[model samples]
Target: MNRREWGLTTLAGLTGLALPRATSAQSAGTGRGYRYVHLDVFTDRRLAGNQLLVFVQPAGLDTDAMQALTRESNYSECTFVWPPEQPGTDHRVRIFGRTAEMPFAGHPTIGTAFALAHAGVLKPAMSKTVFGLGVGPTHIDLEWKGRQLAFAWMTQLKPTFGKTVDDAGGLAAAIGLEKDAVIRPAQEVHTGSTFLIVPLATRKAVDAAVLDRAKVDAVLTAAGVQRRGLYVFSTERGQDDATAYSRLLGSGGIEDPATGSAAGPAGSYAVKHGLVPSDRAASIIFLQGVLVRRPSRIHVNVASAGSEIASVKVGGTSVVVGEGSMSV
Candidate 1:
């Protein structure tokens, strides 16, 4: 079948695999084989979260090969795990989206940790495991959720808050929404990577959002907000613990089921902007991808020192959907 028929037009020329499947080339004893696993992150239930593919012990693979594999997987993001180059770190992870590499992302971090534990590379205990990433060392605390499942809490970087868009009407139209759909000024926040956080008035407005890529690109370029994507959110909660509903539209037109990286800064934004009570620690749950049928629940914890934000943590569970070997 052609790339168009396979629903994989993003990397057809680069990867040469449209809706690629795993291909085994090296045997186990070759010492050059790679084991890849697919994971459903931010959800305990199977097949109901952001999909992540992790390539274990990606030895002998160069950047081009890694990017090819990621594009082939067709997941929102994929990771290559390696031994840490930095001292006192357990592992090193290189994150890649369908079209490019990412400094840091939420679900990939949580899912990668879960995959490591599942493969016996890292034991699932009460302690934390730190991975040296492109952004820096990221920490994850793990606990057993069931006989076959685990939950991971990942600590993200301290937010470097950025500018807030004053022209709400222009911002809304840029993303193909009505003027009044934008509830407030859109703010830029970067935990490790940057994203424009747009607040919509209602859940319907959020669900109705359609990105005109040209307009979005033009707006972002003019605003000097250099980042991968935009995160549109509403105060309307669809679940009990959910504080809001969110959707992330990034480069390559990838819509994330749940975005962990954005959640960290978003949680901090809630505290800083007083969207939620800023009196104490806050737990914010973001519901996403319901419109796409792959529902995800992301847990975000934000702590503050009075008016100042202290730290932000993003956590969730993941389930291994499939595992196989890949040939380099």
Candidate 2:
């Protein structure tokens, strides 16, 4: 489909969903308020990707208020954009999960860039923007199809390969998969965020896997990587355009539809382990969130310099679904 046709189809699909409405009760009182934009990240169509809420003008909102709003929305993550405190950055974005603030996250970073552009804070002529995240300065490159933002890519930190877990049976059981389904030993990888990358045998194995939180935590804790979550993936692709199928199961068995932070490391791991050709630049597409009905397609590009990974970039498209305001 053409760009216009694709945009219209996405709009039509999301129109029926409830748009954000101002909280009249809170607006009536002395409570402060902030405007927010709703977005679906990592998908061209609406309502099918990971959801994000972005507060475009969150001047008065404190940390407590941001955390409260994140819990209220119950989305995987939310972002509050602030004036840049550092040099050469466009804005400073604070990302918050359902319960606490995060150092950095994938969907929120790209989704917030789209949100800023949609809100007119970013001009169409501007092709790039940098966000000062908790992890430090994060650079985002923008691609525009005419005036519309077609895609955004975030350059993540260099990959740090950590401990390798030798307990294949324990790792498999943690995610309710058979030991035979594991194709290789699990290893910890960090690119801003940390995830234990588990190589599974097939797409069916990835989809069939379920998170056993207690067991998974036990395995991670034993490896001295208790803070990291499980990122199970199979290089065997069920979709023609994808290189892999994957899932991110965090503590409490919560599954993220799309994980941008993990995608960088995932691509790095793929190139290092020969899952993808390492002779040249590698571009990998990961299909995730299908099991939860919210499908997300994440793109990763890895540049190799000799035996080392030169750079890692994670990117995707996002749709601005809805908008509204809430009291802070």
Candidate 3:
């Protein structure tokens, strides 16, 4: 086991105290109670999408304790919310990577929205929830199935374009991939945070890739990227022809089943590379996670004006899968 896991396990054993079981409980209220909601992001079926752990009405937990709790949960990332303590603010969300706190995460946003729905917080159900985050705020749109919230559409942060890596071959090796699998002129993409995007020749390449964290971290650190990103595309372009079929991976030890942030820039790559015919505009599907048994779907849109591209967008549905209580 990794040191992080071992430490957590050892700590748990030594204290003779197990983590608070991930079960829904009643909120401290006269009537409304707390409930846990599980969302499977970027997939249609349960367990097919990236699993998320959401804790609702976590008003008592402080930031340091929340970070510790995230390590205990050990998912790629965990999200906790303090119910609206003031007007105009929906919820205060705190995000944490297994080892540290993060400013934002896409899957968590979608998953949290659905969790709120499952808990009946969004019963009247407006079109969406504008989750307040550290960086700023993100929106989540809800879909109703006869008063029951079934799906949520999250509008990711406004994307940012960064320097291009342009070395598909070397990057492929950085992630334990073959030269042929690397896509040429791969660029860095981000929305709110930075990620190095190295496209591979096929989805098979991405599926087989195992990121050498040390190498990836070095490159990303030098380039000022918060994380390394890997995107693989299918030759067969589905959806609109302007963007190519693709999947995205991050620097986190755990692979992201789908990366909406990466999708935004990947769509532009398809348009500029001629993989997708975007003489006018760019938009496409980025199918991810089929190789990992977590079938995921992500949509990307690119706006190109003449020879220059104007902007990009990524949209997807997040399914809430599970919830937990943290007492560490």
Candidate 4:
């Protein structure tokens, strides 16, 4: 094991003492340590997409421990599952990024539902699993191919348009691109969390782009864009002609392989700016994280009723890569 894995294994040993027994082993009796499943989301193929770790039954790990565990996993995001606190809910999920907890995130919620169903904790016959997230009850629809879970689609919260950065020159400098490279004004939109939506001139600009944290912070601060996630997309797309090539840059200089949360707001931004037709049901294929070698494909669907957006849904396939037990 590498240093992080070794540290996680050691923490797993202690997690058994901190949390109550949910189950022992894979079945029967009570258990201490939490079982975690690792999966690659937004891609059907293994080793692509974004890496996510889901703690199947985190009974006792508090905020600090969850944050620490997320840092140790070093993945884009980690999730913890608990029994639902409200009626008509399948589970309660808490999402954590590398350094902090998030109210809502796209891949973690989807991946956690897949992990739960794969573990037999969630019923295969159930078509939808409602996770009580910090934002609210977010529903994920499941597809079954025989007895196995084949696909998952999440209905995100409504889009809330935030600030708009009209200073295209300043915004271009923030993310390592030319003034002519920015196609649209930088927009801040939120579904559950906020993201600065940037439209680039071409796929090459999206690919060659590098993040200057100082400039990025300066631009965001100047525009009053509180959310630090930067999402840039190009119409030229990747791997497919219909796809929109995209990348999501976190505050720590980490680029997300596939960003579901940002996808929702991006769809709204596109429709709002007439980048994509919103006359009817529309779908945008997002190809992201290729420069980092973890190519991910995110399918973003938007339904519009006239000028207003009816709903936004994000869906993708995932495959289990690994599984282990984590102590508190």
Candidate 5:
């Protein structure tokens, strides 16, 4: 089968005996094994949140291998540790995908924090505990969600809103929609990694999207937003906590059921476009992954200091679903 075939098919196409494997090159007894912990993020309800794979204390795996592991897992993202944050070492949290190391990704951040908290690694704080990642330090507030460890709040990195790529028409047309359905001048928004915010006219528009990889690749190549350009849309009609609907589409041979990093930036975009009332930088709820069927709820706060703009923070709840020991 061709890669394009895989791209065209839904996620149900890839479930089979071909996913997990144990390479014969290493012994399970090596100082190279990894511990797995499952994290359910963004929603208090179990199985209704984002899933994560936490590699506790992966101190010996190299870069290329970690990248390959994420590709093999095929999850949105995975995390690792180089020195294993012992009794006194600074935790060097590294994130990876099929492609490269991402500076930051939301669910992984939440999951990592949850694991650290459960492991008794981080000192508990009343509000939140700041975690140091490869990108930088981040804070996550831990709470007991009915005998389960969950995140009450998470403070994201500073946002960066850049040029609105002048290719909305081309993109909408390529995605099998009327040119006008694509929101004008797709803006680059980022709290960790930048994503091109392309607003669709309605929920129906979002549901029927047909973004061929080739078309998006061509447009992004033309506009020079390579390795980025995640498309997000919402069913939000009037904008309220329970009504805020959204989804994230990866144009680069991927799909994110829950995108906290991208959604944080989208909250910033919402404030910039005046979609949400600026009430002294409020925290709001965003519902994502409904169309894709994962059903994630990400919380975001957009702070506006008298029109001067401020920080945007996103966080979620997580539950451990599975765990395993792997021979690296």
Candidate 6:
């Protein structure tokens, strides 16, 4: 569908979903209203992938206000876009979770780009848009299908591999899995963010695993690695389109539907450990959020120069599910 038609259809769908509408009285009392777009990232369909709320014009919202709005939205994360602070960037995006601000996050970056493009902030004919994130300038390559945004790819930072945890029993216990379920050693991997990449034996094992936060903290402490979320996956996909079935359980016991930041590190770890073929540039697709019923498809392309990873690109499609305004 064309962009206009697609937007109209999305609004119709949002009306059916019964999203809250701001009344005139509310707007008047608040003085100004911030327009925000709702999007589902890492999926083509609405209400399925990772949910991200992007405030297109957040001129008056401070950092605390952003965090409050993020918590109010009750999504995994939200983004506030501002005029470009860096010379070469198109915009500056601040990512906030329910409680704190994050330097970088995968779905928020991709979803914000799609939201801006859909709202006509970014030109439809432009092939790329850059956002100055907490981690620095992040380049997003855009692809268009007719008048619609087809997909967006973000170039993440270089992968950094850290200490490995060989205590299989402790790792399994930390995630409520059997020792045999862990097929390989768990290791710390970082791209934009740090995640402990755990290789499971089967998709069932990956799904069955649950995080015990106290135990997880203990395991990371003993391994001499900084505390981070766990990105567990299984490569034994029988007929799925994705290369790996994965899940992310954060240290706070909250699970992510889709994790773009972790996907880069996961792809890098897979290539380095021979979990997937590294003979050439490898495109690894991770199927996550299945257990939570918000299935997400995250694509990671890993290019290796001999034994070292040369580049990592995470890309996926997003749908504009809804739009609303918040009085601030």
After superposing candidate 3 on the true structure, give the runs of residues whose Cα lies further than 4 Å from its correct spot. 1-35, 84-89, 176-180, 213-227, 235-253, 272-274, 279-283, 303-313, 320-328
Global lDDT of each candidate: 0.81, 0.88, 0.65, 0.83, 0.71, 0.90
TM-score of decoy 1 = 0.84
**lDDT of model 5, residue 50:** 73
Clashes of each: 0, 0, 8, 5, 2, 0
lDDT tens digits, residue span 175-280, model 6: 8988899888899998989989999999999989988888988988888978878899999976778899999975455678999999999999988998998753
Per-model TM-score on C-alpha atoms: 0.84, 0.88, 0.73, 0.85, 0.78, 0.90
Question: Which regions in candidate 4 have their CA more than 4 angstroms from the true location?
Answer: 1-32, 237-242, 251-253, 279-281
What local lDDT score does residue 301 receive in model 5, on the 0 to 100 scale?
82
Name the candidate, 3 or 4, with the larger lDDT value: 4
Candidate 5 has which clashing residue pairs, if any? 40-318, 40-319
Residues 179-280, candidate 2: write the lDDT tens digits: 888877788898899888888999998888887777777887787776577788888856477888999875565778999999888888888888878643
Ranking by TM-score, best first?
A: 6, 2, 4, 1, 5, 3
User: Which residue pairs of candidate 3 clash?
Assistant: 27-34, 38-320, 38-321, 38-322, 39-319, 39-320, 39-321, 40-319
Rank by lDDT (best first): 6, 2, 4, 1, 5, 3
**At residue 144, what lDDT does model 1 achieve?**
74
**Model 4, CA-based lDDT:** 0.83
* Candidate 3 global CA lDDT score: 0.65
Q: Is candidate 1 or candidate 6 better by lDDT?
A: 6
Of models 3 and 4, which has the larger TM-score?
Answer: 4
Candidate 5 C-alpha lDDT tens digits along 1-328: 7987777575556664386566665445465567867677777666767777778777667888788778777777888755434343346678886689888888888778777666666545434655566567766666765545556566776678886668888988767778877765668887777887877777767766776778877887788776465555753564445435666765654456788878888788877876667772476677777766678878888887776567777877776677776664
